[model samples]
Target: MLAVALRHLLLLCLCVPATPPLLAESAAPPAEPLSERQRDQIDAAASYALATTLFASSDLPAALHAFERAWRWDPGEDQLLDRIVPLAVSLGRADEAIRYALIRAGDGSVSPEMLRRLALFASESEQWDEAKRLYELWLQSTPESSNAFERAMVRIELGRLYRRQGNAAEASACLAKIQKKLLAAPNSKASRQIITGLGGSLSQVYEMFGKCHLEAGELHLAAEAFSQARDELETDAAANYWLALLELERSQPLDAYAHLQQYFAAPGDPLGAAPYELLRKVLVKINDREHWPAELSRLREQHPDSLYGLQAEAETLAAAGKADDAAPLLRRLIDDALSEAAPIDEDSFAACGVWLLRHYAATGEANRVIPLVSQLGKVHPSLDPYANVIKAAISDNAFAAQVNARLRLVADQPQTNPAELLPAAYLALTAGEIDLATSIAERSLADDKNVEGDDLLSFAVGLLLADQGEAGAGLIRRALEQGAVDEESPAAWYYLSAGLRGVDDTEAVNAARRAAELAPASPEFAANVARVLQAAGQTQAAADEFAAVLRRFESDPDPSTRATLRETRLSYSYLLLQDDRVDDAVEQLQQVLDEFPSDPGASNDLSYLWSDRGLHLQRALRLAETAVAAEPDNPAYLDSRGWGLFKLGRFDEARDNLAAAVNATDEADPEILNHLAYSHLALGDRGAALRDWRRALSLIDDAQQGLLRAEIEQRLQDLARQAGVGEAPEKNPH
Candidate 1:
């Protein structure tokens, strides 16, 4: 009878109940009144059954509570005690996990797995002493049945914990232990299986050693360690990637390239686009850009169905100006991925769709783009609003009726997401249907509960970008009145400042000042105040404010904060130059370059400045090249590079880059156009120069670009005199 009872107890502890315990109790009740111990046992069993059910149903918190209840009712069930800690730990119930784990530890028979879990939990919670003690205990208690790799992983965790606590000596001690274990680990198939199966790779062990050496500034030792990590498992992608990075840091591009190629070719899940980007960096460093096309073709041929291959092919097609060839491949890729029963490769599908959309948008093929937009929304529903905006923005007058019908479809649905209505409003605004646009905007904001401050601000910014500032300002005011965001928040005031800048200068300045007051330490808010002051014609005040903000962030410890400061200085310099403070602007830009020599934005701006002034033409060209390399598709960077080349008398190169810049920009900037015109004139294409200059002149705002407008006018007169034609013969810029 005793043996049967013990077996039954064990069975109940091991098995998770599928049927409700209440149902079982009702079916078979005790004949007589139960004793306290018997009642407790029955209650414990019931609670355990409930807990397991909750766990299976994915109600973790409720499961944890029920598990705790079971433990409280019957503490003698040790197997039952085992279930609580893991559940508690998973649910982030730190106190509960620790309490139960300590109870098991007190028994001096806790399993090594439980001890390791406790150690990791302690480490994550930042309980330095507790974590170290638990880790040390785990290392000591690791069963002889456990492999060396498992023991080494425990030591590595201890080493990482020590590093987190800034105890370098203790960390080194842990690393030494791991290294000894690694050296002794057998190179047999069983040993490798144990290591890999247990999720502890020999490569990972060496990688940790490399990291320790690297952190200690022992570069040579770090390199050797990383090399050993790569050699330990020739197929290890992580080891190759780390070694490649180290080689790059050591200025060994050729070595990095070999390792990167091995990493790229390693069998694994597709590495996506990052490896290709890194490969490009190495190729650029070696000045072997001519090999790029061949390398891309080889990669594509080797892995035709992989993301890496597809990305390489896309870049190849784009570079060769073969969008027509790329279009079918991209469409097929997206179609195949979507039609598959397996999980889709979302990033690859989206990239293909974006490429197709961009090609259509550029070519003004609204009919083609609209269908693609619909297809994209199936895979990425979050992009629906954005896709709609793109559809509307690219559509011509011929597509206006189609766009209006889509808007009407959305408008008829009373409970549709308000975000869906914004594209229609934008479309109407662009189509010059002001009344319809206003009505759509009203409908978008009809449900205040559905709209938030971010939505309002985003739509306002969009409208502002589309040159409907009055409508944008109205939305901003409505958001403020509705208290969509906290009135006291700096962000609200900042939004107000931006929304009202051109509409109401005084209000904008006041709102900017309020934001600055609320967030005195925020460089962005402070910078905005300066910009607002400048826009309001308080030039001296703005300059003083800029100086103050610059001084404040000059000694900031955080690298990101300092980067923001550099951006602020860049903005200040641009504003100063606009106000004709040439010497001040130059000083500010020079200071920014001195502080951040390799910053792409600063490099591009300063390079453009120098080229415009015909100063340091060669140096400007170098800086411009750096910016272009960093962001190849950036129109502004391309314009800067073109201007630099033009200043250096490289007319052919300048013309190519300027033409690329013109193609890249969605709506052409007058300054970029003027630069392109300069390149044309330098190349002796007088007719082309006149045409571009006229286009630039038409785009320039007399209110904001008085100097540029005057320069274009003077250039037109000069060209007229040269051609012996009356006022340079007006031609339609379109």
Candidate 2:
């Protein structure tokens, strides 16, 4: 059996192409001549053989573990995903499946089914934007011969998403397309069956239309459509659920109660106990506490085994500050799921573990928390971060020591998996073992062939934020070097450029320029090149690059691309303003307004610029008003409007707006405070003006706010000289 196993492992190793050694054998020390790549190949082959044997033996969990180990050792082997993705899906490890599927997507090998599943998972997780993107991508890849029902369902979902995003016109257009597709089908028995499955009935369509309006806040229209839908599909219970929601929104609790009753009486609510929570609300509104207990009982009976019941009970206990009462129930739910020989949902299952960990930690049960972390980590590798976090909280010194010991062991090994080291490195960083974490991270980067550049860059940024500048810059250089060889994509170079910022000016600009050269059609990449050039103080070249990208996207119709163009224009205008080109800045702002007429940022910025120059005071005030009306609570908008009002000699109104702006924000913005100070000075409150100016001056830094600081200081001096009282500040010490 051992010989046979060795033969299988040898065959697997032979089948896989040999990855290039991390270091050439000639360059390696005589004592340790085996390169990291050769060690990884051995590890991957052994793990793969073990995985295959376990899979044949029907030990799926062990098989999955072995497969993951193999893949971690051999990330460049794309074929390993063939087994990994399906196994993860079958094991109900949605996150794992999605992660590998995304890798396959990058390699352009993702299946339509995988894409659809990922989209649904995102939607269920309430990551609406990601869900919309995935759904759109899946639809684009789907063929015409795809199932009619599934296609219609996706269209309905798209319409629902559009409405939820407040794009009513797009939602309406989506519904029209769905209707048209059904109507366009051939008139035959098979066609009719397809249409019926596609939800072709007007009533069903109207119900979806009502949902769209509901999400888009067209409540009255939603009610009308729901009413029509309810009449046509009187027995369909779903219409009743929607009608109940509409009635609740309209504040007709009695009607809502009736509809909810019909909805509850129906066989099953696809929404689960979501409506029961609403019913509970309606009962409270109607002051009918008598039915509360019975309703709770009905819900408990509906979802037996204390599934929803235990969750609600735990929540109520926690809310009431009964931590002791909630603990057992939480433990029961967590233990039951863990002990059961059934497939588990990774996210939901791990969420319970995290909650229990939190509870245990809060109660000071480090013992309980440690064991639970061990249990949960076995079930989901993603829980490692959370487990390490909990362990650190329990004893940072002990955890750091544990990580250091593990690091030493890993270092002693001939080859170390970067994946295994990353979590420990992050935990060490979190535990304030900066040197140890940096060492681990450096070791991870040593084998650059398998290094994920994004992960390396992320760790580098983390180190930079943690005040390890030199070390961070070194890792960033390593990531850039790896990305240069492996990814060689515009986005990769652009991100690497961003990573190099504040570290190496020349390299950052070169990387950004390389990205632009690689993808001249990408406005974002080109804009990034321009921005980096501006940062490098090559103003003329920056302006030229900006102009090139703008001209390239001049007639582009993509909304996202147009938004990017608007942002690039704004950035270009800022660059022009910094160079004191007032007319050029105005032209850029005017172009922005022409393209995005109601854009509040452009309006506010333009108004501020015009007010600052004392040019077109009336138009600036109107523009400021427009911006304020759009984002009434925005401090910057209020500051612009107040400054415009101050320029117009409206001291009372200006002071009010300025004060409101000051009071609304947690931070005392120097510019806003300066405007408020001027308003106080105009109102003949020199003492108040002096105080505000001092506060503003204190907040202003000498770096970028030098001019503003000087102006405020001069104003203070003038006011003090006029009053002939206390002396003003002489100058900024720094």
Candidate 3:
């Protein structure tokens, strides 16, 4: 066994084989006196033997020193330098190795091996300039005795290195040489031997060629090269992955799926970084649902805690209306993450907690969010997770105690990162904790003399939405002037549009359009583009964008994609509804509900519209009930149900639900207040109706004032007359 292992280990040496031993001196006839040169050669042979012994013993540093001594003693034994340089480099003495390599090349030595080895070292270490220089020298100094196939391989590697440094013109030059040479001798013995030596590296060369073209945006050429590589090497998983990516880009999902299946079936890749999420999505897009469950189960079994596995399982379960099953899996994942021995970076573990909080928030299961917050609070070093939980609580209508506990969890935590403070401020604003939001925002901006572009943008957006619009805009302008904001960044422009939108500025439209243009692949960005266009009265343009948004999502139907699809449809339909395009809006809304039957927001919106327009009270009641069932604690859904009852003339039950909805949160929503006022009017509590409408009007912003002010003021006057309060109504008690 030792002999067999050593036989294989001999290949690791640069030379093909060791020198043979000489005949025994005692068996030889009497010899003449040695010449000076012969004496030096005999001494060199002794040094070489000692060096070989040291090398066999694995004392590489001593072996290299002895090998250098042998080379010095016998200037004729050039092979000793061959052993010395690579050994030196392997021992982390690269500069010294290169010095000896330069000495050999400058002397126009018989061997180019040292120069070639130096080039390999430089290339492997990513010192592209030195690698390029050394490769050129190696090619120039290569002895005529070197094999043609080995030289061609070096040229191929040099081309690959050039491409890696983004010098595509030079890379193409080298590839063109190889192509030209191949054209001349398509099936030569040299080529056959090179292929035998390369094993799978030939496929890697072609794949890199494809990547060079792909990076240059020459998609057709890239696809051609990748297909050629896949054909040449049937089990080349990298080539298959590239081809799948290119096919998906071309909107050929079935072809992409086929190629991806081939990729995952290949050997030696069960543990490699397969594009599992993209494969899952492509399987979904092409309706290959039958194969997905088994594939995903295999993935989870193999990579249980991987980002792809965890997210894929959780997303699939949630999508199938099995969020209850998904929740415990996410909880266990978080628990396992938190149980890790103090890792150097706990961000990934903390991120797991955020995903659980996100799922609960999205499903309107706010109370489920509290326990994860407790888990994260104990494990996380930063306050970001607590802030995220607060946002979840605000969304899910969680108990005030739960929300307050998370709020306090982050309140005393020291925020060293402005990025951290921004989320906290956003949570405060969303939870109606206005003073805290303002305080954090102001503090963030005041301390923003030096911070990342993301931190500045995040803090600015928080301030803008928290009613410090002018101050926020000022910070944004400074960031723009200082070049901290990239004009082409979709996220930066998106935030810019958010800041400008409150003042109804035309630039907001341009900013939104830019974001849409930069992120044509993002459904959320496209939806934003459509929304701003619709708001700016470019209805036709907005309609086109909304249509584009739908087209973008058809090929990428993850949970977020599905959610955005619903939102895009809703935004477009709301515009149609405003224009009195009732039939068109109804068709789109019906389609949205048909596709996303479990969506609470969709149920509530359509139900509220029916009740508001007096179009279908009975059906609206059913829709409202569905929304309430989906999110029992949601105040908006409760208001919808209460108004549906008011439309059906069930005034007492309407007042009861309206009162419950209004009292659900400390900061009463103006929309719910308006609904409650109408319920009071229907109950003939004229004084109560007048007071509720007045309270709602005071809380209403300019955006809502335009739509509801006239109706609310009219209701107050009629209620005043009914109560006989006459011209005054007890100072419009708020």
Per-residue CA lDDT of candidate 3, range 104-147, in tens?
A: 65555524776777788777767787678777787788764578
lDDT of 2 by residue, 450-504 (tens): 4565666666667777777667766656655654234466665676677667777
Per-model TM-score on C-alpha atoms = 0.40, 0.52, 0.36
- Model 1 lDDT tens row, 456-573: 5665666666666667667767767776645677876787787787889998899899999999888889888998888888877888888889888665534456567777788788
Instruction: Give the poorly placed runs of model 1, Cα more than 4 Å off.
Output: 1-487, 535-540, 666-701, 704-734
Point out where model 3 deviates above 4 Å: 1-488, 534-544, 551-556, 613-616, 665-734
Worst 10 residues of 3 by lDDT: 1-10
Better candidate number, 2 or 3, judged by lDDT: 2
Kindly report which residue stretches of model 2 are placed more than 4 angstroms away from their true locations once superposed.
1-346, 352-419, 426-438, 446-473, 479-487, 630-633, 663-670, 694-734
Candidates ranked by lDDT, best first?
2, 1, 3
* Residue pairs with backbone overlap in model 2: none
What lDDT does the true structure give each of the candidates? 0.71, 0.71, 0.68
Top-TM-score candidate index: 2
**What's the lDDT of the predicted structure labeled candidate 3?**
0.68
- Candidate 3 at 347: error in angstroms? 7.8
